[model samples]
Target: MSKICEICGRKPHAGNQISHSAKKSTRWWHPNIQKVRVKLPDGRVKRMKICTRCLKAGKVQKAVS
Candidate 1:
């Protein structure tokens, strides 16, 4: 599966894991994405990969049929 959201353009982010001992380790943060259907401007439904934040934020208009 693709590690990117087609709708929100969300992708993996790089960061570090901090430990109590003041140690740091490399880590990756990926967006919460899902495969869903959404309505388009033409009133047609289509399947697309979108991030969960967008869904929760009501950025996506309609689900694909």
Candidate 2:
């Protein structure tokens, strides 16, 4: 699967890691994602990949049915 959050569309960020010796290396920062079943507008449950921020912020509603 792609390294992207379906809810927030967050993707991996590329950057560099600096060492004490002044050496730099490529690095990537990926968002924390989780798959969950959420309630839709039509009252249907659907599985989607969401980020931790959204989950913690109560942006996603869990499907009851």
Which one is best on TM-score? 2
In angstroms, give how far residue 23 of model 1 lies from its true place: 1.8
- Top-lDDT structure, candidate number: 2
All candidates: TM-score: 0.80, 0.89
lDDT tens digits, residue span 1-65, model 2: 67688778999999999999989999999998888899988988899988899889888897874
lDDT against true structure, model 2: 0.87
Candidate 1 per-residue lDDT over residues 1-65, each given as its tens digit: 88798876889999999999989999999998788888887988888888898888888776634
Candidate 1, residue 39: lDDT: 85
Residue 13 in candidate 2, Cα distance off native in Å = 0.3
lDDT of 1: 0.84
The CA lDDT of each predicted structure is: 0.84, 0.87
